[model samples]
Target chain A: MNAPTIKPFGECGFIAQIEGFSSDVDSGLFANAVARALRSNDGVDDAVAGIDSVAMRFDPAHLGVDDAREMLLDATNNTPRNTARAKSKTIDIPICYGGEYGPDFDALCTQLKITADALIKLHSTAPYRVITLGFAPGFVYLGELPEDLTAPRLKTPRLRVEAGSVGIAGHYTGVYSLPSPGGWRIIGRTPLALFDGRETHPFIFEPGDEVRFNAITPEAFGAIRRAQK
Target chain B: MMAIATIDRPGLQTTIQDAGRRGARHLGVPQSGAADRVCLAFANAAVGNRWDAPALECTMTGPALSFEMDIGFALSGADMGALLNDEPVGRYQTISARPGDRLALGAAQAGARAYIAFAGGMAGFAFFDSVSTYMPAGLGGLEGRALRTGDTIGSRKATMMAPVDIPDTLRPHFGHDWILRATEGPDTESFNPKTVRHFFSAPFKAGRRGDRMGLRLIGAEMISEDARAMKSSAVFPGTVQCPPDGAPILLGPDAQTVGGYRRIAQVIDADLPLIGQIRPGDRIWFRRIKAQTARQTTLQRQILIASFVSDFSLR
Candidate 1:
């Protein structure tokens, strides 16, 4: 693995980009470990883990930028033992695919030259990791959506994609926890409230969590929604 | 209930804000707080409240409120033609309200957001350790949303202090043209020399899409040498991201924690409050400064704010 490059991001932040990562799995684990380390590290204000980089904000008053950089370098070299991938949570979510719930179902299948049933089976079978949540609040980016499912984002994004809209962009899948403008191809929807500020755990998927989708019928989806209410 | 005031006119996206939640970006939380933090802190300080105390953040339009009980308040940031009991009220100065007194804030004639801070801090649900409202996720503030008509904000009881006046020199002025200082961004190398030159030299107009999330700017099309898809990285307020279309988007306080666009520069911390006051159609010019110089500027601003707070006891 190539050594990570720790560089200044803004005036008060530093990002460590781990280039030439051995594999997606290894990078995910490393990123999560680094993020957890920086989050708890004294003097660090904020920390976010990307695919192969970790961005950290610091209070220059408490710790100078040069000192923070050195601390980050030290943390990167020594990954904490307690934050192993095994400590991550596995969450199974129920999704209603195709029909009215998925606007781009037929179009996506036609473009990929795959049967609808086959597509659903392939998507539901894989266990995806919670890579990051960058775009919006509670929005979780889970990946690596079987390379076969890799697709480009829409040329023109929709003005408003409703909350719980499950979308696939590039090699990842994500759930829009809130209504937002997005370019990802929507393939399904979930009934579960992925984000609720009132709850102790506002977001269902945290970084490092493993997620798998369970295909459900429209009736089942409605039943689950009713039960929650 | 310690009802202090009832919102008669909710105004445009008025909400309670504090210092905001820290060390939560990994949870996809943006530092959602006052757009112009300097003003918020100033208003809070004038009323003898902690710097991070919850305060009302009025948007382009201001709200009309009726006091349930006597209270002390301060108006700062945008001059939204504030009036108390039909009498014109000045900015940067604390004003005392009597029971049943009506306070009104009109449409912004100058800047974008205005801050109205009460003597005692506002009582709102503390989500993720802050009262600052994060609108997109419906988190923090009153019921995790913006203030609406009929909402009666409660206040903590405290000894009333005499109103204090902030010096004119300390007050920020809203102008048509703004100059923001910035430092180099991570993706600055991705842009060609010509684009970099245009970024610093050309003046950009704040587009219609300006909001708490980001301010989209229209200016000289900045072309980058590498059009390859860049990996998403951490983004913060003041980050000037240039998408494939070459238009720049200046991230605001409510911006996404991370993004994929290439950032050429970041507005310096000291100048961020100025960006928050920017309104659509305003002209913006970026001035490049060294990272060391930017740090120094932030330190100076911190000292200035500290001095102001230190004088609070004397006042």
Candidate 2:
């Protein structure tokens, strides 16, 4: 792999970008590893991993800009280019597809020219890994959605997308862990809570976690939702 | 904790904010703190409280409250025209109030936000060890939301200190014109040289859609050379992002951790506080500076403010 390009993002922040790297599983793992290494360093405030870049913010009082830049360069060099797949856990999510839970279901079905059952099968059959958590707390971006399931985001985003709303846009599928304004096209809704601030772990999914969705009836979704509450 | 005051009128959007949650951005949590850290620290310092202590951050308008106990407090940031018991009081100085004293503040005369710090610092729900309110996630602050009428304001333990008056020279001056020193971004190459040059030279007006999250700038459209939608990347406070629509949005302390917009420049740490005080229609001009110069300015400002507020570092 070519050396990553390191540039100053702000006065105290630096971004080490891996150019020519596609948003694939391997790239996510590599970017996440670099971020983890950067975060463990002293004086580093935050080291967030993007799809193909790792942005790091450090304390200028403790670490100079040159030192921060060196650290970023070192992170890219030290991090194994061919990182061995670490032990990851696969979690199952129960989803109720098509209907009130998915506002864009009909439009998406018409656009894709597929039956509702075929679309559901295409979405749930493939297992996706968490690329990166962003935009909101516990919001996990699962990648490489089946080509048939990929859809464009809504032109005008919804004012409030309920928590656990399963959305698809481009080649990524994500769960709206919090009720927030979102532009992703919703096709299903999960009954499980993705984020619980009071808990020790807080988030259900982390980077590299494998996720598989299990289609359920609306009645089961209601039952699981009530039981959890 | 004891109830220190009863909120008679909650301002337009008043919430308890501290230094904000750190080390959580990787998990998608924003650094939602006092938009203007300088003012927050100054208010806390005047009352002899820790610089990062939780305080009420009032936006646009200020709140009215009746004290239930004697307490020492100070107001900083925007001049909200605060009055104690119908008597106008000055800002940036510690003021003592007796039980049953009512304090009211009107709309801001200048600037956009104000900070009210109590003697013992306000008590608020802690999330990730910070009480800064993040309304979107409904985390931290009082019940994870803004203050409302009839809500009781609680305090830790009151510790009265010798009244300290912040000198006029040390206090930050607020105005309609703001010049934010910035460094070119990690994605600066995404835009052509002409667009980048136009961005720095042209003056932009803060649009009406301004909030703690971000401020949209209305000016010359900054068209990116590469029209393809960029992948989502890490964005921080002071990141100037240009969407496909050509408008630029200046991210704030409460902005999302990552976004897909093309970043043009990032405001330096020293000038980040100015972004918090910017109001709609305020004239904003971005001054280009190198990262080394940005660091030097931050250090100079930190040293100047540290003389009055001990242990204060503008990081």
Candidate 3:
């Protein structure tokens, strides 16, 4: 693994950028490890993992900027480069595709020139890895979508996208954990709650977690949604 | 808990806010809080409350509220031409009200936001250890949303300290022209030297699309030398991100945890509150400063504030 270059992020934080790091499962796991290690230290306010970088915010009152940079460097150097040993879980998501739940479904199928069944088969057959969680609380970014499954985002984003809405853009698929304005092409909807602050673990997916989507009927979606409530 | 006031008019966008939600950005939560922390602290201090006590944050327009019980409140930030019982009231000092008294504020005469702090602190829904409202996710505050007409505001009871006045030297001033001190961002090298130099030299105007999320700056197009799409990375309040269109978006308190735009500069921590007071058509200039200087300035400002509000830290 290439060593990350440390740079000052504003006056109270440092961001470690790993050059030539791909947005893949292994890189995400390594970044997550480094962020976790940094967060454990005193004076670290927040340690967040990006696609190929780890940014840490520190309290300057407790630690100087130079000391914070050193701490970030030490955490990066000490974290294991090979993240295969990292413990991650596989989560299965049941999705209701097409019709009302997916407003852009027919348009996307026509744009991609694929039959509904073919598209669903391609999307569900392959397993994906969580690259990161961001944009909003519990919003999970899963990556390496099948090339044929990729689609450009909407020109004008919808003002309100319901929570659990599944969307595709460029090389990745993401789940909107909360109702928010989004531009991604809608493909499906999930019944499971992706975020619940009441729970000890608020997020459903973490970096490097394996994710598999399974097709389900609208009735099943309603049933699962009711069960969760 | 008891109802203190009833919202007569909700105004443009009034929401409950505090210091903000911290230590949850790693979970993709934005630090939703008072857009102007300095003013929030001052308002709270004037009412003899903790610096982080929950308060009402009114946008360009202020709300009309009627008190249901005797209460003490203070106002800070934008001069909103507040009136109590149809009589003009002063700001930065505590004002007592009796039951049935009405408090109303007009459109801001200067800044964009104003804060109203209650004597015993306002009550709101807490999420991630803060009452600050993050409207996008509908978390925190009163049902995690902005105040509306007919909403009854609640308050927490506590042994109150005598109301005090904030020193004039400690109060912040707002104007149409804003000069913000900043440091280089993580992606500052992505732009050419000429564009980087132009960023410092040029003056930009705040666009009408300003909100708690961010403010769009309209000025010279700052096209990046590297046209490759940037990977999503950690972003915070005050990160100046430039998109493909070259328009810079200055992130605010409600900025996303990660973004995919090219970042060229980061407004220093000390100057972040100024971003809150920026109104549409406001002229802004970014002044480059060393990281050490930014740190020193923040420390000095924090010391001054701490002397007035004990245990208050700007960071």
Candidate 4:
């Protein structure tokens, strides 16, 4: 008997999506479940999932879309959500707030009506969840920020937002690892570069991981950067 | 012999590219490389360059690059009206550019991207296992940025090499007469039959917003009646993503590693190079084919390449 819960995803790349859960809860369960479901399928070239859906790319040269969809459905229904299988890693990033290190730090303080010290404490208080990543290379999008800290992007994007600069856009927050044009509200700069193109494993953070930002004095930031180097 | 030119005026988008970096998609980094793959390949062939060898990919037109060293080079893809020191150089062919000679590329006369190939090879910097440059991440090429006015590029040392003797049979002088083949996607049936028919039947124009990431094909809007949201997943080059807006976005070099949009069709691998050559205002149409046929075509091309490489490798 075939497992019967899989459904059709859009046909662009021959993807069949497995039903999933919310990003906030049981995300590990979802990621493992999705990966498990598509692991053994010959038709599936790759499998990636969001909080609510798991998408698979089917190589038609290998199998038809209908067959691929059926295969994914069978896999999802047969396999159980393995939450305990995956462990979340928490990384502490030390950032230098103001001065030449962060160009938009002062502007952010004025806009949010919060002192730098208070912002740091609140930011560090909670473990930010990793959301989806898409804007640029090795860019990780994290969390719904603290309620008061939520802010829109600049009307005109800065020509160059230095890499490792921490930024916020609405409820979403992220860090720029590469120098690219972006419209996020810049709050602080992290001297640590997060993305490197040449390395085999160039990315530090993936979606669904937890992260905490620890504010450090310029001296500490410099010390960490040097140590990493 | 190997040679390179000095930039007098860098055109809109001039960068050195090879096949681009692979396996960086999981991290949201797109594999960026030659925007016009077919023409880039032809130019490489004209000068006996390797398929994945580094070459100058000039966008729109190109900067007036002066020869820093004497070398033979070939230009292909969109005719950029490329000239050497005020004299018109041959298209789909290699010519000599001596030191101090300026290679001027003017407005596009045919296509958007033009490739400049060196005989010995190109001077390259490494990124993601390849020399292809991704501009956004500031990786590859001269500091991961476009070539600028007054910038100097070192030419390949061709002391042991000579100007490649190109065969006239390999030349693709004008555009058109080429048909792109496509295969059904993993999500082919997700869209209603009408939308799928509209895609294969209708003719589309390459939009002005086209970039290395993807081409925004302008034509009938293909809407997915199913309002269900899609999960982010791995996307490949030439994946035809149909947004709710109804237009098809042809993912290209430098495209996102993953996307959440519904994909309707994937341009076959053989046809991806054709898409790269398509510039703004260029006309194109799609035809769906079975995977078997597509695979056969790819295999045929591979056999041809293997035979040529064995007999007369660019190296």
Predictions: Cα RMSD each: 3.0, 1.7, 1.4, 5.2
Which ranges in model 2 have alpha carbons more than 4 Å from their true place? Answer: A20-23, B158-163
Find the 10 residues in a row with the least total lDDT in model 4 chain A.
A7-16
lDDT of 4: 0.68
Model 4 spans with C-alpha error above 4 angstroms: A1-16, A20-80, A83-85, A95-123, A129-135, A143-161, A167-172, A181-188, A206-209, A215-229, B1-3, B156-169, B173-179, B309-315
Choose the strongest candidate by TM-score: 3
Better of 3 and 4 by DockQ: 3
DockQ of each: 0.62, 0.80, 0.83, 0.33
DockQ, prediction 4: 0.33
Stretches off by above 4 angstroms in model 3 are A20-23, A84-87
Per-residue alpha-carbon lDDT of model 4 for A1-229, expressed as tens digits?
2223454333323333433444423543454355545756666655654444455656565887567767666656666555523546877777777787766777888888989888777766777866655557766667757888888767787767888888887666788878766778777778776876557767777666777888878888788789988
- For residues B1-315, what per-residue lDDT tens digits would candidate 1 score against the true structure? 599999999998799998777766777778888888888878987898876678999988999999998878899999999999999998777788998999999999778999999988888877788888887766778877788899999996544444445678898889889999998888888888778978998999999878888999998987678878877788988999998887899998888887888889988888888877898899999998988888888888878776775432100
From the highest DockQ down, the ranking of the candidates is 3, 2, 1, 4
Between prediction 1 and prediction 3, the one with superior TM-score is 3
Query: What C-alpha lDDT do the candidate models reach, one value each?
Result: 0.83, 0.88, 0.89, 0.68
**Poorest 10 consecutive residues of model 3 chain B by lDDT?**
B156-165
Write out the backbone clash pairs for model 2.
Answer: none
Q: What is the lDDT of residue A204 in candidate 4?
A: 78
Of 1 and 4, the candidate ahead on TM-score is 1
Q: Give the TM-score of candidate 3.
A: 0.97
Instruction: Say which prediction, candidate 1 or candidate 4, comes out ahead on DockQ.
Output: 1
lDDT of 2 by residue, A1-26 (tens): 58888888998888887765555666
